[model samples]
Target: MDEIRKNPDIVYTDKSGNRNYGYLSLGCDELSVLGGRSPLQVYSDFMRSFRDEFSNLLGETIMEIQVGMGPAGELRYPSYPESNGTWKFPGIGEFQCYDKYMLLSLKAAADQAGTVGT
Candidate 1:
Protein backbone atom coordinates (compact mmCIF):
# COMPACT_ATOMS: atom_id res chain seq x y z
CA MET A 1 0.00 0.00 0.00
CA ASP A 2 2.76 2.43 0.96
CA GLU A 3 4.73 1.64 -2.17
CA ILE A 4 1.71 2.10 -4.41
CA ARG A 5 0.78 5.32 -2.75
CA LYS A 6 4.27 6.78 -2.88
CA ASN A 7 4.34 6.94 -6.64
CA PRO A 8 2.61 10.05 -7.86
CA ASP A 9 1.95 8.39 -11.16
CA ILE A 10 0.39 5.40 -9.36
CA VAL A 11 -1.67 5.96 -6.22
CA TYR A 12 -4.73 4.39 -4.67
CA THR A 13 -7.65 6.70 -4.25
CA ASP A 14 -11.43 6.66 -4.10
CA LYS A 15 -14.18 9.23 -4.55
CA SER A 16 -15.44 8.23 -1.12
CA GLY A 17 -12.21 9.79 0.23
CA ASN A 18 -12.38 7.70 3.38
CA ARG A 19 -10.12 4.84 2.33
CA ASN A 20 -9.23 3.57 -1.11
CA TYR A 21 -7.03 1.30 -3.12
CA GLY A 22 -6.49 1.38 -6.86
CA TYR A 23 -4.30 -0.21 -9.46
CA LEU A 24 -1.24 1.54 -10.80
CA SER A 25 0.87 0.60 -13.78
CA LEU A 26 4.50 1.02 -12.77
CA GLY A 27 7.11 1.53 -15.42
CA CYS A 28 10.33 -0.40 -15.55
CA ASP A 29 13.12 0.29 -13.03
CA GLU A 30 16.61 1.79 -13.42
CA LEU A 31 17.88 -1.42 -14.95
CA SER A 32 14.79 -1.59 -17.10
CA VAL A 33 15.40 1.98 -18.21
CA LEU A 34 19.15 1.51 -18.74
CA GLY A 35 18.68 -1.84 -20.46
CA GLY A 36 15.32 -0.95 -21.94
CA ARG A 37 13.60 -4.06 -20.60
CA SER A 38 9.86 -4.13 -20.10
CA PRO A 39 7.93 -5.23 -17.01
CA LEU A 40 8.39 -8.68 -18.49
CA GLN A 41 11.92 -8.73 -17.16
CA VAL A 42 10.86 -8.62 -13.53
CA TYR A 43 8.07 -11.08 -14.18
CA SER A 44 10.35 -13.74 -15.65
CA ASP A 45 12.91 -13.46 -12.85
CA PHE A 46 10.20 -14.27 -10.36
CA MET A 47 8.94 -17.24 -12.35
CA ARG A 48 12.34 -18.88 -12.46
CA SER A 49 13.04 -18.33 -8.77
CA PHE A 50 9.57 -19.55 -7.90
CA ARG A 51 9.93 -22.75 -9.91
CA ASP A 52 13.36 -23.57 -8.60
CA GLU A 53 12.53 -22.91 -4.96
CA PHE A 54 9.19 -24.67 -5.18
CA SER A 55 10.77 -27.71 -6.76
CA ASN A 56 13.59 -27.83 -4.22
CA LEU A 57 11.33 -27.39 -1.23
CA LEU A 58 7.93 -28.84 -2.10
CA GLY A 59 8.93 -31.00 -5.05
CA GLU A 60 5.55 -30.62 -6.67
CA THR A 61 4.48 -30.72 -10.27
CA ILE A 62 3.41 -27.09 -9.95
CA MET A 63 1.53 -28.16 -13.08
CA GLU A 64 2.17 -24.78 -14.64
CA ILE A 65 3.42 -21.38 -13.69
CA GLN A 66 0.54 -18.97 -13.46
CA VAL A 67 2.22 -15.60 -12.86
CA GLY A 68 0.08 -12.54 -12.50
CA MET A 69 -1.11 -9.97 -9.99
CA GLY A 70 -4.32 -8.80 -8.41
CA PRO A 71 -6.21 -5.46 -8.53
CA ALA A 72 -3.54 -3.93 -6.26
CA GLY A 73 -0.79 -5.02 -8.62
CA GLU A 74 0.10 -7.00 -11.73
CA LEU A 75 2.20 -10.04 -12.53
CA ARG A 76 1.42 -10.08 -16.24
CA TYR A 77 1.14 -13.54 -17.82
CA PRO A 78 4.19 -15.22 -19.22
CA SER A 79 5.04 -13.28 -22.34
CA TYR A 80 5.08 -15.24 -25.59
CA PRO A 81 8.06 -15.26 -27.86
CA GLU A 82 6.30 -13.22 -30.53
CA SER A 83 3.40 -11.88 -28.49
CA ASN A 84 1.56 -15.00 -29.78
CA GLY A 85 4.04 -17.78 -29.28
CA THR A 86 4.80 -19.70 -26.10
CA TRP A 87 8.41 -20.55 -25.45
CA LYS A 88 10.21 -22.65 -22.83
CA PHE A 89 9.84 -21.81 -19.14
CA PRO A 90 12.86 -19.56 -18.86
CA GLY A 91 13.27 -16.28 -20.65
CA ILE A 92 15.42 -13.11 -20.61
CA GLY A 93 15.83 -12.50 -16.84
CA GLU A 94 14.90 -15.95 -15.47
CA PHE A 95 13.04 -14.43 -12.51
CA GLN A 96 12.82 -10.88 -13.80
CA CYS A 97 9.26 -11.10 -15.06
CA TYR A 98 7.35 -11.06 -11.77
CA ASP A 99 6.51 -8.60 -9.02
CA LYS A 100 6.39 -8.93 -5.22
CA TYR A 101 2.89 -10.34 -4.97
CA MET A 102 3.65 -13.19 -7.33
CA LEU A 103 6.70 -14.05 -5.26
CA LEU A 104 4.58 -14.13 -2.10
CA SER A 105 1.96 -16.30 -3.73
CA LEU A 106 4.56 -18.76 -4.89
CA LYS A 107 5.89 -19.00 -1.33
CA ALA A 108 2.44 -19.65 0.06
CA ALA A 109 1.65 -22.29 -2.53
CA ALA A 110 4.91 -24.07 -1.84
CA ASP A 111 4.26 -23.99 1.88
CA GLN A 112 0.87 -25.66 1.58
CA ALA A 113 0.70 -29.43 2.12
CA GLY A 114 0.21 -31.45 -1.03
CA THR A 115 1.39 -34.46 -2.97
CA VAL A 116 4.64 -32.50 -3.50
CA GLY A 117 5.05 -34.34 -6.79
CA THR A 118 3.35 -34.95 -10.07
Candidate 2:
Protein backbone atom coordinates (compact mmCIF):
# COMPACT_ATOMS: atom_id res chain seq x y z
CA MET A 1 0.00 0.00 0.00
CA ASP A 2 2.78 2.42 0.88
CA GLU A 3 4.64 1.50 -2.29
CA ILE A 4 1.56 2.21 -4.39
CA ARG A 5 1.17 5.57 -2.72
CA LYS A 6 4.80 6.42 -3.33
CA ASN A 7 4.90 5.23 -6.93
CA PRO A 8 2.11 6.94 -8.87
CA ASP A 9 3.29 5.33 -12.09
CA ILE A 10 2.13 1.90 -10.91
CA VAL A 11 -1.52 2.88 -10.54
CA TYR A 12 -4.25 4.60 -12.46
CA THR A 13 -4.85 8.30 -11.82
CA ASP A 14 -7.79 10.52 -12.50
CA LYS A 15 -7.55 13.75 -14.43
CA SER A 16 -6.90 15.69 -11.23
CA GLY A 17 -4.16 13.22 -10.19
CA ASN A 18 -6.24 11.26 -7.71
CA ARG A 19 -5.07 7.65 -8.02
CA ASN A 20 -7.48 4.72 -7.82
CA TYR A 21 -4.96 2.78 -5.70
CA GLY A 22 -4.95 -0.29 -7.95
CA TYR A 23 -1.80 -2.03 -9.11
CA LEU A 24 -0.68 -2.30 -12.71
CA SER A 25 -2.51 -4.72 -14.99
CA LEU A 26 -1.19 -8.11 -16.08
CA GLY A 27 -0.43 -6.84 -19.56
CA CYS A 28 1.75 -4.12 -18.16
CA ASP A 29 5.37 -4.79 -19.02
CA GLU A 30 6.57 -2.51 -16.23
CA LEU A 31 8.53 -4.31 -13.52
CA SER A 32 6.69 -4.61 -10.23
CA VAL A 33 8.18 -3.43 -6.96
CA LEU A 34 8.23 -7.03 -5.74
CA GLY A 35 11.46 -8.68 -6.88
CA GLY A 36 11.58 -6.44 -9.97
CA ARG A 37 9.37 -8.93 -11.87
CA SER A 38 6.38 -8.14 -14.00
CA PRO A 39 3.04 -9.18 -12.55
CA LEU A 40 2.37 -11.71 -15.30
CA GLN A 41 5.80 -13.23 -14.93
CA VAL A 42 5.39 -13.44 -11.20
CA TYR A 43 2.04 -15.14 -11.61
CA SER A 44 3.55 -17.54 -14.08
CA ASP A 45 6.36 -18.42 -11.73
CA PHE A 46 3.94 -18.97 -8.89
CA MET A 47 1.76 -21.26 -11.00
CA ARG A 48 4.78 -23.20 -12.14
CA SER A 49 5.94 -23.69 -8.58
CA PHE A 50 2.50 -24.81 -7.51
CA ARG A 51 2.30 -27.34 -10.32
CA ASP A 52 5.74 -28.67 -9.54
CA GLU A 53 5.05 -29.04 -5.84
CA PHE A 54 1.67 -30.66 -6.37
CA SER A 55 2.47 -32.87 -9.31
CA ASN A 56 1.60 -36.05 -7.45
CA LEU A 57 -1.82 -34.80 -6.42
CA LEU A 58 -2.83 -33.19 -9.67
CA GLY A 59 -5.56 -35.66 -10.63
CA GLU A 60 -6.50 -37.15 -7.26
CA THR A 61 -6.63 -34.27 -4.81
CA ILE A 62 -6.89 -31.34 -7.19
CA MET A 63 -9.77 -31.50 -9.61
CA GLU A 64 -8.92 -28.24 -11.29
CA ILE A 65 -6.42 -25.44 -11.00
CA GLN A 66 -8.11 -22.30 -12.15
CA VAL A 67 -6.10 -19.22 -13.01
CA GLY A 68 -7.66 -15.80 -12.91
CA MET A 69 -6.77 -12.27 -13.90
CA GLY A 70 -7.45 -8.77 -12.59
CA PRO A 71 -9.36 -8.00 -9.44
CA ALA A 72 -11.05 -11.12 -8.13
CA GLY A 73 -9.78 -12.87 -11.23
CA GLU A 74 -12.34 -11.28 -13.51
CA LEU A 75 -9.97 -10.08 -16.22
CA ARG A 76 -10.99 -6.46 -15.74
CA TYR A 77 -9.72 -3.41 -13.92
CA PRO A 78 -10.54 -2.67 -10.30
CA SER A 79 -13.02 -0.07 -11.39
CA TYR A 80 -15.50 -0.47 -8.55
CA PRO A 81 -13.12 -0.99 -5.68
CA GLU A 82 -14.94 -1.13 -2.38
CA SER A 83 -11.95 0.12 -0.40
CA ASN A 84 -12.58 3.68 -1.54
CA GLY A 85 -16.15 3.75 -0.17
CA THR A 86 -17.13 5.73 -3.24
CA TRP A 87 -19.05 2.97 -5.00
CA LYS A 88 -22.43 1.51 -4.22
CA PHE A 89 -24.75 -1.03 -5.74
CA PRO A 90 -25.80 -0.22 -9.31
CA GLY A 91 -23.21 2.53 -9.48
CA ILE A 92 -21.31 2.60 -12.75
CA GLY A 93 -17.66 1.65 -12.53
CA GLU A 94 -14.91 4.01 -13.56
CA PHE A 95 -12.31 3.40 -16.21
CA GLN A 96 -8.89 2.34 -14.87
CA CYS A 97 -6.37 2.67 -17.66
CA TYR A 98 -4.60 5.83 -16.60
CA ASP A 99 -1.46 4.20 -15.26
CA LYS A 100 1.84 5.45 -16.63
CA TYR A 101 2.61 2.25 -18.53
CA MET A 102 -0.82 2.22 -20.16
CA LEU A 103 -0.57 5.92 -20.88
CA LEU A 104 2.72 5.43 -22.66
CA SER A 105 1.26 2.67 -24.79
CA LEU A 106 -1.77 4.78 -25.56
CA LYS A 107 0.47 7.65 -26.59
CA ALA A 108 2.47 5.42 -28.84
CA ALA A 109 -0.66 4.06 -30.53
CA ALA A 110 -2.12 7.53 -30.89
CA ASP A 111 1.09 8.79 -32.44
CA GLN A 112 1.06 5.91 -34.89
CA ALA A 113 -2.45 6.86 -35.97
CA GLY A 114 -1.75 10.65 -35.98
CA THR A 115 -4.06 11.31 -33.03
CA VAL A 116 -1.57 12.47 -30.45
CA GLY A 117 -3.54 15.39 -28.99
CA THR A 118 -7.02 14.31 -29.84
Candidate 3:
Protein backbone atom coordinates (compact mmCIF):
# COMPACT_ATOMS: atom_id res chain seq x y z
CA MET A 1 0.00 0.00 0.00
CA ASP A 2 2.82 2.41 0.85
CA GLU A 3 4.42 1.71 -2.49
CA ILE A 4 1.19 2.34 -4.40
CA ARG A 5 0.65 5.62 -2.55
CA LYS A 6 4.09 6.84 -3.53
CA ASN A 7 3.68 6.18 -7.23
CA PRO A 8 2.97 9.40 -9.14
CA ASP A 9 1.64 7.55 -12.17
CA ILE A 10 -1.36 6.30 -10.21
CA VAL A 11 -2.74 9.78 -9.60
CA TYR A 12 -5.39 10.60 -12.18
CA THR A 13 -7.00 13.98 -12.81
CA ASP A 14 -10.35 13.79 -14.51
CA LYS A 15 -11.54 16.43 -17.02
CA SER A 16 -13.79 17.88 -14.32
CA GLY A 17 -10.73 18.48 -12.14
CA ASN A 18 -11.44 15.68 -9.66
CA ARG A 19 -8.21 14.18 -8.44
CA ASN A 20 -8.54 10.40 -8.15
CA TYR A 21 -5.91 8.65 -6.17
CA GLY A 22 -5.88 5.06 -7.34
CA TYR A 23 -5.10 2.72 -4.46
CA LEU A 24 -5.50 -0.73 -6.01
CA SER A 25 -5.24 -1.77 -9.65
CA LEU A 26 -6.03 -5.46 -9.60
CA GLY A 27 -8.41 -7.68 -11.56
CA CYS A 28 -11.02 -9.90 -9.89
CA ASP A 29 -9.15 -13.02 -10.87
CA GLU A 30 -6.02 -11.71 -9.23
CA LEU A 31 -7.90 -10.64 -6.13
CA SER A 32 -9.80 -13.91 -5.73
CA VAL A 33 -7.01 -15.37 -3.64
CA LEU A 34 -8.34 -13.62 -0.52
CA GLY A 35 -9.71 -17.02 0.60
CA GLY A 36 -13.54 -16.81 0.57
CA ARG A 37 -14.04 -13.49 2.31
CA SER A 38 -16.98 -11.63 0.77
CA PRO A 39 -16.49 -8.46 -1.22
CA LEU A 40 -18.16 -6.45 1.52
CA GLN A 41 -15.63 -7.73 3.99
CA VAL A 42 -12.83 -6.82 1.64
CA TYR A 43 -14.12 -3.30 1.25
CA SER A 44 -14.55 -2.95 5.00
CA ASP A 45 -11.01 -4.06 5.56
CA PHE A 46 -9.75 -1.60 3.01
CA MET A 47 -11.69 1.22 4.60
CA ARG A 48 -10.39 0.36 8.05
CA SER A 49 -6.83 0.29 6.81
CA PHE A 50 -7.24 3.56 4.98
CA ARG A 51 -8.72 5.18 8.07
CA ASP A 52 -5.86 3.92 10.17
CA GLU A 53 -3.04 4.86 7.82
CA PHE A 54 -4.47 8.09 6.43
CA SER A 55 -6.54 9.49 9.27
CA ASN A 56 -4.82 12.83 8.93
CA LEU A 57 -6.03 13.19 5.34
CA LEU A 58 -9.61 12.19 6.23
CA GLY A 59 -10.16 15.04 8.67
CA GLU A 60 -12.31 14.84 11.82
CA THR A 61 -14.62 12.04 10.61
CA ILE A 62 -15.91 9.96 7.74
CA MET A 63 -19.29 11.43 6.80
CA GLU A 64 -20.08 8.88 4.11
CA ILE A 65 -18.78 6.16 1.87
CA GLN A 66 -19.97 5.23 -1.65
CA VAL A 67 -19.02 1.90 -3.11
CA GLY A 68 -19.77 0.62 -6.65
CA MET A 69 -19.41 -2.94 -7.86
CA GLY A 70 -19.74 -4.83 -11.11
CA PRO A 71 -23.14 -6.23 -12.00
CA ALA A 72 -22.06 -9.86 -12.32
CA GLY A 73 -19.14 -11.62 -10.70
CA GLU A 74 -17.75 -12.82 -7.41
CA LEU A 75 -18.08 -9.33 -5.97
CA ARG A 76 -21.57 -8.78 -7.25
CA TYR A 77 -24.35 -8.28 -4.66
CA PRO A 78 -21.86 -7.34 -1.97
CA SER A 79 -23.40 -6.12 1.27
CA TYR A 80 -23.45 -2.38 1.93
CA PRO A 81 -25.68 0.35 3.27
CA GLU A 82 -28.96 1.04 1.48
CA SER A 83 -29.29 4.75 2.17
CA ASN A 84 -29.78 5.87 -1.43
CA GLY A 85 -26.27 7.35 -1.44
CA THR A 86 -26.76 9.68 1.53
CA TRP A 87 -25.04 7.41 4.02
CA LYS A 88 -23.15 9.25 6.70
CA PHE A 89 -20.47 8.35 9.20
CA PRO A 90 -20.41 11.41 11.37
CA GLY A 91 -17.06 13.14 11.90
CA ILE A 92 -15.63 11.49 8.79
CA GLY A 93 -16.19 12.89 5.29
CA GLU A 94 -16.79 11.10 1.95
CA PHE A 95 -15.04 8.31 0.09
CA GLN A 96 -15.80 6.95 -3.39
CA CYS A 97 -14.86 3.57 -4.72
CA TYR A 98 -14.50 2.46 -8.32
CA ASP A 99 -15.69 -1.07 -9.08
CA LYS A 100 -14.87 -1.96 -12.69
CA TYR A 101 -11.37 -0.93 -11.79
CA MET A 102 -10.28 -1.60 -8.25
CA LEU A 103 -9.42 1.87 -7.07
CA LEU A 104 -10.39 3.85 -4.00
CA SER A 105 -10.36 7.55 -4.79
CA LEU A 106 -9.67 9.37 -1.55
CA LYS A 107 -10.91 12.93 -1.74
CA ALA A 108 -9.24 14.78 1.10
CA ALA A 109 -11.47 17.83 1.36
CA ALA A 110 -10.01 19.45 4.40
CA ASP A 111 -7.95 22.56 5.09
CA GLN A 112 -4.88 20.46 4.44
CA ALA A 113 -4.87 18.95 0.94
CA GLY A 114 -1.96 17.88 -1.24
CA THR A 115 -0.05 14.89 -2.48
CA VAL A 116 2.10 12.94 -0.06
CA GLY A 117 5.48 13.94 -1.45
CA THR A 118 7.77 11.11 -2.34
Candidate 4:
Protein backbone atom coordinates (compact mmCIF):
# COMPACT_ATOMS: atom_id res chain seq x y z
CA MET A 1 0.00 0.00 0.00
CA ASP A 2 2.80 2.39 0.90
CA GLU A 3 4.52 1.68 -2.41
CA ILE A 4 1.35 2.40 -4.38
CA ARG A 5 0.78 5.51 -2.29
CA LYS A 6 4.23 6.73 -3.24
CA ASN A 7 4.08 5.65 -6.89
CA PRO A 8 0.58 5.71 -8.23
CA ASP A 9 1.78 4.34 -11.57
CA ILE A 10 2.29 0.98 -9.93
CA VAL A 11 -1.44 0.40 -9.89
CA TYR A 12 -3.51 -0.80 -12.85
CA THR A 13 -5.25 1.78 -14.99
CA ASP A 14 -8.29 0.75 -16.98
CA LYS A 15 -9.37 2.04 -20.40
CA SER A 16 -11.75 4.43 -18.67
CA GLY A 17 -8.82 6.04 -16.84
CA ASN A 18 -9.63 4.56 -13.45
CA ARG A 19 -6.94 3.32 -11.16
CA ASN A 20 -7.58 -0.09 -9.66
CA TYR A 21 -5.92 -0.76 -6.36
CA GLY A 22 -7.36 -4.24 -6.10
CA TYR A 23 -3.80 -5.46 -6.36
CA LEU A 24 -0.38 -4.34 -7.45
CA SER A 25 -0.23 -4.15 -11.23
CA LEU A 26 2.84 -3.98 -13.44
CA GLY A 27 4.18 -1.86 -10.59
CA CYS A 28 5.83 -5.11 -9.63
CA ASP A 29 8.18 -4.36 -12.52
CA GLU A 30 9.54 -1.15 -11.01
CA LEU A 31 9.72 -2.34 -7.43
CA SER A 32 13.51 -2.24 -7.61
CA VAL A 33 13.40 1.52 -7.99
CA LEU A 34 12.07 1.81 -4.44
CA GLY A 35 14.71 -0.51 -2.99
CA GLY A 36 12.25 -3.36 -3.16
CA ARG A 37 12.30 -6.71 -4.94
CA SER A 38 10.01 -7.97 -7.66
CA PRO A 39 7.19 -10.31 -6.66
CA LEU A 40 8.73 -13.25 -8.56
CA GLN A 41 12.10 -12.59 -6.97
CA VAL A 42 10.54 -12.45 -3.53
CA TYR A 43 8.71 -15.70 -4.16
CA SER A 44 11.88 -17.37 -5.39
CA ASP A 45 13.74 -16.29 -2.28
CA PHE A 46 10.96 -17.66 -0.12
CA MET A 47 11.08 -21.06 -1.83
CA ARG A 48 14.84 -21.18 -1.37
CA SER A 49 14.54 -20.32 2.30
CA PHE A 50 11.78 -22.84 2.81
CA ARG A 51 13.82 -25.57 1.18
CA ASP A 52 16.86 -24.74 3.27
CA GLU A 53 14.99 -24.53 6.54
CA PHE A 54 12.71 -27.50 6.00
CA SER A 55 15.05 -29.88 4.25
CA ASN A 56 14.16 -32.66 6.66
CA LEU A 57 10.41 -32.27 6.24
CA LEU A 58 10.24 -32.35 2.47
CA GLY A 59 8.59 -35.74 2.07
CA GLU A 60 7.33 -36.30 5.60
CA THR A 61 5.91 -33.40 7.53
CA ILE A 62 5.60 -31.17 4.46
CA MET A 63 3.97 -33.14 1.72
CA GLU A 64 3.63 -30.39 -0.79
CA ILE A 65 3.64 -26.66 -1.29
CA GLN A 66 1.19 -24.76 -3.45
CA VAL A 67 2.32 -21.66 -5.23
CA GLY A 68 0.36 -19.04 -7.11
CA MET A 69 1.04 -15.79 -8.92
CA GLY A 70 -0.69 -12.42 -9.10
CA PRO A 71 -3.49 -11.10 -6.92
CA ALA A 72 -4.81 -13.32 -4.11
CA GLY A 73 -1.86 -15.50 -5.02
CA GLU A 74 -3.72 -16.52 -8.17
CA LEU A 75 -2.09 -16.35 -11.60
CA ARG A 76 -4.61 -13.92 -13.08
CA TYR A 77 -4.83 -10.24 -13.85
CA PRO A 78 -6.71 -7.89 -11.54
CA SER A 79 -9.44 -7.26 -14.07
CA TYR A 80 -12.35 -6.76 -11.72
CA PRO A 81 -12.28 -4.30 -8.87
CA GLU A 82 -15.44 -4.47 -6.86
CA SER A 83 -14.26 -1.88 -4.40
CA ASN A 84 -14.14 0.78 -7.11
CA GLY A 85 -17.62 -0.12 -8.38
CA THR A 86 -16.32 -0.16 -11.95
CA TRP A 87 -16.90 -3.89 -12.29
CA LYS A 88 -19.41 -6.38 -11.06
CA PHE A 89 -19.94 -10.10 -10.91
CA PRO A 90 -20.58 -11.84 -14.25
CA GLY A 91 -19.11 -8.91 -16.16
CA ILE A 92 -15.99 -9.42 -18.24
CA GLY A 93 -13.05 -7.86 -16.46
CA GLU A 94 -10.99 -5.13 -18.08
CA PHE A 95 -7.45 -5.47 -19.32
CA GLN A 96 -4.70 -4.31 -16.92
CA CYS A 97 -1.95 -3.04 -19.19
CA TYR A 98 -2.42 0.72 -19.15
CA ASP A 99 0.51 1.24 -16.80
CA LYS A 100 3.81 2.39 -18.26
CA TYR A 101 5.78 -0.64 -17.16
CA MET A 102 3.38 -3.09 -18.75
CA LEU A 103 3.30 -1.06 -21.92
CA LEU A 104 7.09 -1.11 -22.24
CA SER A 105 7.20 -4.82 -21.57
CA LEU A 106 4.58 -5.43 -24.24
CA LYS A 107 6.48 -3.29 -26.70
CA ALA A 108 9.68 -5.19 -26.08
CA ALA A 109 7.92 -8.48 -26.62
CA ALA A 110 6.35 -7.24 -29.81
CA ASP A 111 9.66 -6.00 -31.07
CA GLN A 112 11.35 -9.27 -30.28
CA ALA A 113 8.64 -11.12 -32.20
CA GLY A 114 8.80 -8.67 -35.13
CA THR A 115 5.20 -7.77 -34.53
CA VAL A 116 5.91 -4.08 -34.03
CA GLY A 117 6.25 -1.94 -37.14
CA THR A 118 9.45 0.06 -37.62
* Greater-lDDT candidate between 1 and 2: 2
Question: What lDDT does the true structure give each of the candidates?
Answer: 0.40, 0.68, 0.40, 0.74
Q: Cα lDDT of model 4 overall? A: 0.74
For residues 1-118, write the lDDT of model 1, one tens digit per residue: 5544543333222222222123333322323422344346756877788767787555355555554474434644323232223235455512222343333444556668552422
lDDT of 1 at 75: 47
Worst 10 residues of 4 by lDDT: 26-35
Which digits, one per residue and each the tens of the lDDT, describe model 3 over residues 1-118?
3433444233223323233332333323233324454334677888799788978767456566555544332333222222433334443323333333223323332224665521
Per-prediction backbone clash count: 18, 0, 9, 0
Between candidates 1 and 4, which one is better according to TM-score? 4
Model 4 lDDT at residue 112? 90
Better of 1 and 2 by TM-score: 2
**Candidate 2 off by > 4 Å:** 1-6, 30-33, 68-75
- Compute each candidate's TM-score over C-alphas: 0.32, 0.74, 0.25, 0.71
The C-alpha RMSD of each candidate to the native structure, in angstroms, is 19.9, 2.8, 18.5, 3.3
Which candidate number has the best lDDT? 4
Q: Write the per-residue lDDT of candidate 4 for residues 1-118, one digit (tens) a residue.
A: 7776887667788877788776566646545634477755766788899899999999999998987765577877788877788888889888877776666677788899989632
Task: Report clash pairs, candidate 3.
Answer: 61-91, 61-92, 61-93, 62-91, 62-92, 62-93, 63-89, 63-92, 63-93
lDDT of residue 86 for candidate 3? 34
For model 1 the local lDDT of residue 74 reads 66
